[model samples]
Target: MPTEAAFSWPREFVWGVSTSSYQIEGAVAEDGRAPSIWDTRCRMAGKIANGDSGDVACDHYHRYPQDVALMRELGIGAYRFSVAWPRVLPRGRGQVNEKGLDFYDRLIDAVLAAGIEPWLCLYHWDLPQALDDLGGWTNRDCAGWYADYAALIARRFGDRVQRWATFNEFSVFTLFGYAIDWSAPGVTDRDAHLRAIHHVNLAHGLGVGVLRDLLPQASIGAIHNRQVVWPEQDCDADRAAAALLDEHWNRAFPDPQLLGHYPPQIAAAIEPYVRGGDMATICRRLDWFGLNHYGPIFAKADPQCTWNFAWGEAPADAPRSALGWPTWPAAFRDELIDLSRRYRLPIYVTENGAGGSDSVGADGAVDDPARVAYLRDYTGALREALQAGADVRGYFVWSLLDNFEWGSGYGPRFGLVHVDYTTQQRTPKTSFGWYRAFIRDARG
Candidate 1:
């Protein structure tokens, strides 16, 4: 059991919930919104489970006012949401979509009107199809294109949105989207994977520069899904394997953005696949580092792992999410300390939640005790890290509503509010009440 001491965080520690545009904002084809890579990918045969699409996801585009009301009632201090790139720049670049901008304008005002701060994430894996057609992240020119888009959005909305995130989970985009071929613009080529990672890192740094130039007072960072990596055994081979995995998965982006360099081992590993001058563009400074940590990974030496990557294993007895990810809050605290020591930048828990098989009880309540416990454990872990001297600043639960779950579609629920997709009804889960109380206590 976790302790509930008289622990208190700094008054300014942000407590909020997070959502992405594509995940919640339906109206995919409206307001000059062209197809994103996600849109195109979901329509492909056998791509998304249940053939689900975000065409009418959660209908947040239409019901944002209600959602803002929910946030106010929940007593959250801030909300972190992403801007859909395709919505603002229909063809990726060349023209502005006023209607699309108007949607966000109203949404931002609604959030502020409800007395809730709005944190904006510029990109959340919803790359415009036009950009993907032009080679996407694999193309070196994409870094410049993304920077221009960032400048445009920052210049337009930065006044109202004081906190900005350049990208959501950069490593996930490169790993699942390019290397593993599990996400949009999917391609399973190792060289493409390395190129995509470097280009995405460069795009983030360049985007930061643009945001800094445009919004001088705005706090900016990139959200990375970091994990504490450990060897499954004490053997030298397993330790070496774990080190290699850490160099790529853990140190790759943080070193570049925070320390102004990539880990030398990672640089050497991907050197032959790197294009000219990519590293220089990637190594830019950031004001803060956004970390989305859930659990640790137990890595073992696997000679057959791609790029000599270490194989990760979750103990059979460990609790698992609906997505089969292991639940390990202890690992979460360790990751926070490790990142604080390595980067020395204020960190935000940008996204952390567990998905489970949730159901609406006969009493008209969604009983999600598992999710409630998960949040409790993770929050305790976060507090532990703070007590241990991590420069932590905020926490944003993974989602506010259950919408499209990528390849899994709506099969997995990771929201405080349960959505009946068929009727478009929204109902807060038991975990929602617990979170509201948790926030109240934290604030107190």
Candidate 2:
């Protein structure tokens, strides 16, 4: 028998699945839409797995109504999706593309018609290629640029959209895309990373102000992947290394956004970029706090490094996802408890799901028992934290369908519903049925 999650929630809690535009909506050339950084990066040789460019991945751009129907059938209360920057302001600034905006207008309408609340995320790392030409996130001008874009969308969709988020996973976009060569705008500059950090936070602060002013009745927040920080082993160096990384990856954004300043450890490293009043702008009052946690990343000290730390792998004996992420539910619970107590805001598990080797079985249905188990364990742990007084308000699965998985491409599946890339067929796996039952049972 499957281990059912003994969890309950308030009647008004937000429950849904999360998806980003670049990952699922695959009409790269349609609607006068300008190319995003991911679109440009995908075409480069050896960038994505199987040379996939999301050119035709899942074709959700054309098939969103069917996808919305899936959400409705799953009995979820909300749907969180991102608006592609290039799709709205194709050039990322000047003229707004009416046709591109029309697509989202239709998507939000469909979601509303299905009786599902639309939780809109302003940016999800799909910066316009044109904006990349203008120094992208590293450019201080991006703060105003993003604020303008936020105002445009909040004005357009605020009527139907009940919840809003500034950006999804700030650390990932800055560190992976800027500091490392794995993601789009692929570069390896420490100074650029430091600069981009403050700029992105500035954009968030400005974006939050736009949402608050335009959508005063709606709840506003930002999604961050600030999970449990741990050391590689019981060693002084590793513990020290973990502290620095925790300061950078975990506290760097939220502290300034919530507490009005950076953690002392990395403050000097990024002080050059911190102009006057930037911290005040970053620490906007949020109605809720969005946390995306999978598991813990243990850090190890390294002498020859400027950052002085390296990402050490999780314990080998632990349950592992197909993407090799540690499936540690205790860490998930710890994070939920920590955030609820520290942030003092209604916590939402914005993105939490395991990446699995999902496939369409010979019988034509997808079988992903591991993902079902992963979700069960993690949510059970979330329930335990809630029972122990964590003010966790809701949980949204990482994705609704398997589309682009970023640098790892489409190889890792993180969706309850499996997507056959070739046929654009959507098959709800075992986890889908499990989630549906769980929601139905919890609500009842």
**Best model per lDDT:** 2
TM-score of candidate 2 relative to the true fold: 0.96
The clash tally of candidate 2 reads 1
Alpha carbon RMSD to native, model 1: 2.3
Worst 10 residues of 1 by lDDT: 303-312
Model 1 regions lying over 4 Å from their true place: 1-4, 231-241, 272-280, 298-305, 308-311
lDDT of 2 by residue, 166-205 (tens): 9999988887787667888887788888988999999999
Give the per-residue lDDT of model 1 (tens digit) for 358-424: 8888898999888888899999889999988899999999889988989889899999999998888
Q: Model 2 off-target regions past 4 Å?
A: 1-7, 303-306
The CA lDDT at 59 in model 2 is 88
lDDT score at residue 246, model 2, on the 0-100 scale: 92
Clash list (residue pairs), candidate 2: 257-283
Candidate 2 RMSD to the real structure? 2.4
Query: What TM-score would every model get versus the actual structure?
Result: 0.94, 0.96
